[model samples]
Target: MPAVPGRLRAVCLAAAVAAVLTGCSSSDDGSGTGSGTGSGEPSVAETPRMTLTAGTELPLDAYERSEDDVYALAKAQNVLTEQCMKRYGLAYDAPDPSPPAHIRPNARIFGLVDAGEAARYGYGSVARTGPAPTKPKSAVLGETAKSVLFGPKTKKSGKALAEMPMSQTAAEKKKSGLVVNGSPVPVGGCLRESYLKLYAPTSSSVDIMYVFNLKGEAESRALSDSRVKKATKAWSACMKKAGYVTAAPASAARDLGFSGEAATGPGAVTAAKADVACKAEVNYAGIRFAVQSAYEKRSADRNAETLGLLREQAQDRLRLASQLTS
Candidate 1:
């Protein structure tokens, strides 16, 4: 729910050697936003209320960064990190950042909406149902390069270097007191330094996760709203009529025992197609999306001041990222 699901958190920390990039990486919310590297889409807050569709931009979107923004920021970070590694006489070429394919950003937020997708991959995402992508070959790092790229292991604690606390500022890097290749390894090495440069430039920088937390809260509220519940019940009845018994669309895949490889089987595909049809018949997605948007509007209003600050910080980062990448 926190934009960056637990599964993608490792990708965020894997600053070095991200060879096979996909659609959404860090801060992915199963939902997509609009263009530009700035805050987000125009204020849907003032617009007249209308029936919402799958992948429709919500009001809180103004405070959120789009997937394009996340990728641009990541590429800039990679460029900066590679440049830092060059300073230490190590050759490093960071791969472009991307999210997994077939994930139509919020397409499945309430349940599958695309009939074609349901027929092909069933409950599984394209990334999971299709063949794995080939990983690009990267240069192997020697001990010296590894030590400089990722800080050396602690002597006393025997802690994994990757698990070490990372410094988010230059001052913190300096205080870490780590030296590699006749130079200071910024707290958690060049990766952490690149992160600090792009994300947390100052000690007082607001956390990037702040907006996502608010979005998640609103989504949670929308789930329990009476209108959404009513729609879900109608969808359930429709699915039952189609010979697929399930309590809710959200749990259909699990209830049907579809997991991993089984999700892509013919049986799953048939059920998935039926599931999507039922959702459409009952207007489930429209109802849930509308209710969720209303909740997001309320949350945005309550946190307007903080959201404004976060938006400004995001814009600043995007500007700097452009310069760094260019």
Candidate 2:
């Protein structure tokens, strides 16, 4: 899916989880949570703690951004627009980029402690690494083009145009009530018609809002969960020992002066590696992942009906995307 520029990244949802970290205890080995069932270090390890694996499809994660569908839909819209423009003896062109192979799940709490990530980007992975994604190219349609692609405006010249009411029937919907750019604009514009064909097939608004606010509810809980606080404190102390003082790995990565390409370079390799090492040493990933998962599970149970509908629409969109791409 095309990403809006300057979109805020995902944050920790650890605090949202309602489960208590009962079995956890601080281990002398520096891997424990420091408080739980007796002993210096926690007797039980991360294994006993609930953790999400790839085998699971958590509710929030199941709803994905169907990039392939979005790109294909965009192309379809462009083609439709081109045909519409040709009616006026004008040419239209749009460039659609291929979708990404896969988007990584949020790691706001995990902090890239994954062994593979540690071996690669190191501390650089602590923050979002690499440049922002490129948006697919599409012309900024002018009034005439907009009229051709969407619907005509009520006037030949204006800053805003009033939209005419739409009818349920296709033929009726095509009836024009307003003149835009000297052309009659229909109730339900052609552009919107094309969009409907590829997405929102059920005309369900839940499908729209589901993807729009995927993790809003659950993540908020996790961010404030006690488990998250404990994990962050431990991770912060570990980072301080490495000579970096930050509340979380995200904070370290967002320093601007020491992040991304700056810290990812060969010159800063050691620090990058150390960041990952500290993350593992303090078990930040384990703690946060478990806590967040608890919250997500709770949310899934509570919003089953709404989420189920959203999931169906999401799957429908995925199928449409596959058909278009194929």
Candidate 3:
């Protein structure tokens, strides 16, 4: 129920790259202000929550998306875009989709909570301790191709959009759109065609992140639950005893000042180990994860219909993707 970093997201922007990108990287919870009746779990009678069995740690039975679902859709969309551009004598090469995190979704969200990471660099962006990833080389496009696939930049503004008030005739508007090769941009624009081919018109409106955001909300709520509060207090005391005064995992990481090359040094490693030790002693993560997971199970049960629709759309898009490639 910890919003998996790559899984939770808002849906409105999904129209542009939901299938491809949500499948790529992630975060968000849509709920506004809580009732704020804080400091404990609600007194209402609760459903008996299940504990983490090997099979039940994640409530995946409600729905799931696999790496294949994302990769296939991305590759297929690229293929379509490439072919469309070929027709207009433009070279189009789509980059390979970014790799998914190797850890479970929850692990990616919490980041350095991974034992290896904690032992190594304490808490910080990996780049704090090590070199950043190399940028992948991308295909180069010509001016015509860029203008055709993306709209032509306005000559006056040097931007994709024109000065709204300055526009007048329909012909000028059309001219502003594209001048691909020697013809108008192919129907629907090359990128739009590729997207339509990979996803349903209706899916353009669906929020890919709804389920994930709900998971985030569950996490937020769990943070305030009485059980979590108790565990957090115990963890805080342990850290304080070690001369590290911090209330929560995030705060501990921050107060440690995990920036620059110093993050990988002796002091940082020592504090990180203590942080991990405290978490284990208090069972803070275990309790929090369990509480949030229960919340997610409840939410998934309640929102099964909408979740099903989103999953089906992803499946359908991937199916089309496969066919397109085949």
Candidate 4:
């Protein structure tokens, strides 16, 4: 999908450590309570603990866009980009912004949380759990359209553009001198222009990726946290008892040598089931979630001023998106 610069990059960075660590830095679990079950030892819940399923939002969710909102923003941006292209006498159709219904955004953020999903798909996707995906829009762009949608095709300019941040890229695009049919291509092309129109809008715009970057930082810290280490070690032992030899949940899929059809085969299903079972027994997800939350809370506290501005900007961006799409 054609996206604003940094959106997918930030998401990719966050997902890179998806199975390893994920969390918010706050102590509150969004429940009115001020604490969570982060203790190193496992304890029986007096009542049923809410299963940390794909639909469960982490504490950091407050600072980020929801999956539906993401799709809405992308669709709105597509409309704006197409309009911009029309002004330059170019045709542009951005890819569909719809996401799969069954697969929630946080599906694998904790990695293989659902035993039922594991039993059916193993390490494979939960595609079978959802409706057939919508056919994507054709994204073929003529060389002219490409240059206009993006920027100049010169190797030197391409190299420079690739390294520059979006803000700088937008500034440079003004003097790019790459005119199309007597019209100057907006900075970074129509794609970038549409992004700026909704997300940036001004030179002082707070980076949309700021909260995402902070979450990534928290995840990194949570990975090394003592509480997390203890819980994971217990999980590893639990896995070992179940005849799996993985040292950590993150490495379990890789350690079990399986590929292609074998990945979702009986053996894969068995191992995945064991992995999820061990995680539950050791309370791995809850512990890690808590640890990451604490880290994120500290990060958010330190950056409160910037985060406040970013939050306002994000809401305004959504309002503008609604206006554009409406």
Number of the predicted model whose lDDT against the real structure is largest:
4
Cα lDDT over the full model 2: 0.51
List model 4 lDDT by residue over 1-326, tens digit each: 00001110010001012243232332232333243233222211111122364665544567777656787898898998899899888777788776646456566776787888899999877774545568887788888898778866567645324332356345554555678899877656777777877777776788787777887877877787655676677778778788888877777888887567887999999999988877776667766655565555556556778877877888888888898888
How many backbone clashes does every candidate have?
Answer: 7, 20, 2, 5
Model 1: runs farther than 4 Å from truth?
1-54, 99-105, 126-136, 155-174
Worst 10 residues of 4 by lDDT: 1-10
TM-score of each: 0.73, 0.64, 0.68, 0.77
TM-score of 3: 0.68
Q: Say which prediction, candidate 2 or candidate 3, comes out ahead on TM-score.
A: 3
| Whole-model alpha-carbon lDDT for candidate 3 | 0.54
Q: Give the TM-score of candidate 4.
A: 0.77
- Please list all clashing residue pairs in model 4, or write none if there are none: 24-293, 25-293, 25-296, 25-297, 26-297
Model 2, 18-46: lDDT tens per residue?
A: 23233433342242423222222221223
Tens-digit lDDT track of model 3 for 1-326: 11211112221111011111111112212232122123333221111221222223445334555544655777888898888788788877777665543333345333244456667666644422223334666778777777667555667866655332211122223344455556666334567556655553443334555666776776777677655566677777878888898877767767778656667777888888788777665555555555555455556656777777777777676677778789
Error of 3 at 112 (Å): 4.2
Instruction: Highest TM-score: give the candidate number.
Output: 4
